[model samples]
Target: MIGRTRLAVDIGGTFTDLVLSLPDRTLSTKLLTTHDAPDEAVIVGTRAILAEADIDGSALDLVIHGTTLATNALIERKGARTALITTAGFRDSLEIAYEHRFEQYDLYMERPAPLVERDLRLEVPERLAADGSVLLPLDEAALRRLADVLRAQRIEALAISFLHSYINPAHEQRARDLIAAAMPELAITLSSDVCREIREYERTSTTVANAYVLPLMSRYLGRMREGLAGIGVTCPLLLMMSSGGICTVETATRFPVRLVESGPAGGVILARRVAALGGYDRALSFDMGGTTAKITLIDDFMPQQSRHFEVARAYRFAKGSGIPVRVPVIDMVEIGAGGGSIGRVDPLRRIAVGPDSAGSDPGPACYGRGGTAATVTDADVVLGRIDPSRFAGGKIALHPALAHDAVLTDVGLKLAMTTDEAARGIVEIVDENMASAARVHAVENGKDTAGRTLIAFGGAAPLHAVRLAQKLGIGRVVIPVDAGVGSAHGFLDAPIAYEVARTFLVRLDGLDQALIDALFADMRAEAEPVVRLGVPTGELAETRTAFMRYRGQGHEIAVPLDNAALQPDTLRQAFETTYTQLFGRIIPRLEIEAVTWTLGLSEPHVLPRPDQVAAPAAAAVVIDTGRMVEAATGETVDAAIFARTALRSGATLLGPAAIVESGTTTIVPSGFAARVGYGGEIIIEEKMA
Candidate 1:
């Protein structure tokens, strides 16, 4: 008999991908993203996939979803009309972020405008010390007076972030109660609830961002649930979070800020799984969809994670050019180098690719949806890298002539070159862009890409994977099954999990084990309920980490803590080890202090290991051959084409070649060879000289 049936849905900038996993086989589909009603495409796609699988929606055991809606809201500034309430004299914290210019040399640099306008940033007379002691009592009368002003401004959401609320929630909680009583209809977000950390600006920014998107996310979640039920999918609907975990809809709705990187997080999860299955100790995950390409490094089958990341950068994709949110997130670098990224010639007569995209509505010029600009897709079609008839499984027909015209007009004529040369230049520039991003990201993490295998996925990644690998000095690339919808597949592999972070500063020598134990107990009390809502019967796994740094230092490093016991000496040793690993040395005389504590609770999951395959004695038969431009040389070459489904385990083929599938195509470049693994994944490796 078949076991549980699951469906995973991912909504990206240009496409909505769905994966339906059955006991015997898996089915997948892709649809253009419906910007106006994002859920409409999902509902329709769900019905179609279910019908194709010969199953009903009622047969689904679970449904997991991840979307870029929240991130888009912040990027486009299309969220609700929100107001902020802060302690007196700190109303400018959002504007006074870091108090230093992120780009010191660029005189024309601009900072991202705060989500809450200055006038909407109201203040009340209340104060709290660093130790959670009350310096001045709450002025309820002053807070009440702001209600009229908020009403006059027609505020849809409110954010309350008082000074030092991370240490004690009394004032923030009381303020929330009072506000709820007066303005029951307003959506309010509390800093203590969203981000309980030390930095004043980051905490306030996180709270305000949460408030800004609360109403919109709440309504969207409700509509999604209703829409799913309307199609007879009454199973539990879980949501993918930025931390590579799936949580119940209720938990996700309450903390929608955690969903900003949800879609890309799923891709990392899938990469981690692929790394483990392929027995790769180090890997680089490359996910290139329609609008952006996300690159992440994986060590020991774990993706690099962070407690803080900026969003919606306003100045040249600089670090401090966006709003900072303090939450658990997978660390990665996203660049605008996807299939639909626009290509243009600058005034200097140089080729430039994007941090912008022509999303599905107009898409690429080849899509024939009214777009006139040359995009990466247009370049690919013009270069013969993509088959116009087989694009998107024939759901959408592509116009090669339109692609050639767009490329010639936008880049060729400007550069005084032919259509093929301009297209190749566009592709080469975008690949170099991605390569530079990967190199920088790896160096920033104190790692190198020399020995790491590239795990390529998403709709556009496979077409450019080998070239990217060659640029990074990587010898191997693994294109897993269902690469086009890899992130959606990852949703099915995620564990039900939740994480809680708290700020508690103390010297290592003065750390109180009893107090720390109580603190952890409280944090567990906070996170367990959230995890249990999604998984009730499984044994929960726990992980602990402390953000430690030298006394009086401005930064910290994460040190893993043991779940068994807490000892001062052990803590010091762990901190020193982690600190030394990062900086190559640690100060011996300075005392270390713990600034933040994090507790993660997740349901345990056991992954089935892939079976090993032996070497093949025979070469795979060629299905067909097509002409394509070789990456190593600028000359056109005849490349063999094979059906992925027809290639069995241990089957091998030489390049240049294309392995075609319904959802995506894997391109094996001129100097590489391809092989089929036990799990039906295509492994491409460089040819020996």
Candidate 2:
């Protein structure tokens, strides 16, 4: 069963990558993502890979997928028509946000617009005390009137979030039952079910986000299932979640908000696997696609995980300016600095690269796809960084002349510089943007990135890895085998897993062992069915967590919990131990509080152990024939181009070389040399003068 064929698909912003794994080998293919009909790209790429492998789709044991549709729908404002129902007098929570300025110095800073407009948000009379007790009874008549208004307005989806729902959930559940019974055809999302956190703004925003994407996700998954069935495939379709786990299509449709950032999560997973295999305890995973770039940190073979992320920021790098959604997400920083990001002259006459992208349909000017704007890809082509004839495994021919023309007209003419100078500026600016994001993320997590190796992947990462690494002061870089299709390949390596989170408050002064034990039991029972639906029988693993904080604090930190049943004394000791590890010292005589609890159950993972290999002795360096190329200093220098596939273990190729592969290109700047490691990972080291 372990050797059976498996299929993995990753739908990205600009391309769809498909990977087919047979018993003997693996094959991969890429196609331009069809935004108008996304399933068409999936079908075409899947069929191509299956045909290449010479196997029918029915023989596949499982099909796993990761997609950006949910994220894209929210960012582009293309989701279903949604209406919000909330507790009376709290309809303005989404608009008011936290009332703190993200940019303190700016006199005029605008907050992101709410997903649901004021007109679509209706209120009902209901109230619950903070201690899970009812204060004001729910107005059933008001709920019915809201339902009538929704029906009359033709609302496709609804979000219900009552005050204090996280504590009791009685009112929220009752409202949902009433709404569903009244309008059976409407898609509904309850705040308690989506997120049971304490913050009203975050909870309401998350529920609204879930409702907004619920209808679109349901229709898309239904179409994909039918499309696969028509092609004679009869396997269960699983979707990758932002939490770095896989769930069934049914779960995805029910909670589509979890799918946001799913595609980037796959890349982080791949980077972790590579780090473990290469025996690196810490590393940075850099993924640059056509429309965005992502950076994540990995420690001890696990990517950093967070329960908070935002979408569509009003300012590029500032936090708290975007719509916040509380979900389990692989913690990473994403920016719009991909290959197709447009370059233009700003009002200040300074050359600027983007938060705007050409995307797949119009693509970059060099793709001959009806785009006239200059982009990062166009800059690389015009600057002689990428070969005109070898992009996307030679499937697409890049027109260098068009790139030069676009740069000259749009950027160079206004800046009074040559085309090459403008191209260089664009590349440097984008690389700085990625580096700045990495630095900020590391500092926030109490990490120093200088000692970490950079693992580069995606369509655009290899093109910019050297310069980005130089900026970060990182001395080593690794380009894994099949780096271009890294995300799709990661899908084949994922484990069948599910995570469940709930809110239950407890003060440490009066610890109750029986209550805690019952909480864990209930969590396991709720998660078992969801995990079993995707995994085969008799293989599962469980992990528990507690969100702990000092009394009177508004935020909490996640602490790991032991699975063994414990007495009150033992639980108190464990809480102190975790608190000390996080904050250096426990607060003196301050009582600890447990805000919420989470339980995650997963299928047993079959991860490969790192193979022990003898260290290789230094060997004589080999130099391929060199070519003369223009350098950044406006001087011609001798550079070597080597075929990455032909480089053997311990082979050292020196400075100013281009390691060209079918899927990606790596440029080795002056004063650096690359060595092939044992696992086919290319490691670049700076040569001492």
Candidate 3:
């Protein structure tokens, strides 16, 4: 059985969100992120939320944390001093990634520099054939000689990767032993341990990434645990993984690279849960916080999942432009379009929002912090989309004059327009930017987003969801309860789970059933301990998947298999069914090969079910507020405002209106109307002309 008192914290690039839930009620808060110590924000937010709930930290039964620290550390190159140990002649595999340029036409394209410099990428004289046969034994003397060199370099963490290590990790394990004996204090990450997959470059890069952030994550998690304990909270601290599952802190510390997408994963979870509650079959999740906006596609109440994802891409959405981390992740497209996204006039005198953010240290000009930069928040303030006095539940009073000045100086002056017009341009551009991204992502996944309901959450999503939906040609939007801290709330709904994936190349006809069984058993052995640590006493469920593709294909599509005894015919039929659905037709007469296998262990979640969920009614209230400028028409109109809590399940309110809450506000444009659902969720739909 789950505990009654639990807490969830999600630390993003700009804000730290916290939710403290008790039997009777739930309390949540959002604070600007403290970059110096992400845990500091969590502790402070936790304390504040508990105080509001009138409960001591010690009363909490569990603590769940999800953070973007790993992602930030990689993008900023702020991880510990690291080095790489690889097989001889393959030291440049990570550097010589993919061989060709990701942006081929650009002659001046610059590659993402490898984390480890050339000097630090030490090579051990060893060779292994494709079949994992030891061709040249590892030279112990030579490896020991490099010990002095590594010690002098003062490397805090080391990554060891060897050719054919996926098939046989003997050489990699030996190298790790030698290094540990020499530098016992070093944080070592082995490729076979982190990601035992094919693709030498990706494997090495994933290992290097794990090692790079190992020390930092270890320290941060330690401090978080201690900090909570000091504050009278003595509960197990679980972490949200990128795969939308909760894990023990030990598991997260071992593979912090998996936490790169942890924060966004929570948002996806929230969308999926809320989608299921509202009975939305096809929905798009738009999570817009202060630093970034994440778009995830959900079908039949399940968010899309992928085994591999890229991070820190130079070309924002370019697939191969970032470092690839082979970990279970919720598939989504993210963009630097958020409330704190900086807005500026480019050289061509065109207004542009980010790919870069102001964050919290110096937030938007309207935040009244040290920030003077014009940001999307400032534009929203200038356009009257955000109420100055009610921003952040009135925790931070906004200054409209400063916002107006920032917008006028940054955009209006550059383009010879008024502050309002410039703000309009910024909002329009950002909305279109998100819509374009959604369209691109949908096309890539063979999905059409036109008919999907937009489940908008996070601090900024509700403020922009209706407009974004309009831009996407979507007619409906849902903003769940406590939308501001949606991700943190999502953590409470997650289950104790872990996934283990490894490369085990085999053809269906030549597949060794015993080997496959052993492989899955080994994977279960690795994941069960982690899941058991989190769940302690629960029935754990196991799911198996094989990544299969036609012969000669570069990548494979995931095909689920029966957890019972596997056979060649069953595997082939499953692969063909999924392949046909994906491509409309399977390649005939081609041999099929399985490249990787993944085993997931999870405790069953007692999912919530909403009752009396229904569509928006055709009735609405005509409560009018002061005149506000119409987003599309440039002319001021009498916009209505409604208190969200005062409305019941069947109550409807038409736009142009602002549905106000303490921490979040949903803007329904004149072309739309909103109705309250049985789950207390606000559903907005377009109005017929």
- TM-score, one value per model: 0.98, 0.94, 0.97
Screening candidate 3 with a backbone cut-off below 3 angstroms (N, C-alpha, C), the clashing residue pairs are none
lDDT of 3 by residue, 440-558 (tens): 98887778889899999998999889888878888889999989889998888888888888888899889999999999989999988888887777579888999999989999998
Per-residue lDDT of candidate 1, residues 215-323 (tens digit): 9999999999999999899999999999998899898888899999999999999999899898887999999999999999999888998999888889646889999
Model 3: runs farther than 4 Å from truth? 1-3, 613-624
lDDT order, best first, reads 1, 3, 2
- Each candidate: what lDDT? 0.91, 0.84, 0.87
Tens-place lDDT per residue, model 2, 418-515, is: 98888888888899989998998888776768989899999889888978888898888888877888887777777767777777788877767788
- Candidates 1 and 3 compared: the better one by lDDT is 1
Worst 10 residues of 2 by lDDT: 620-629
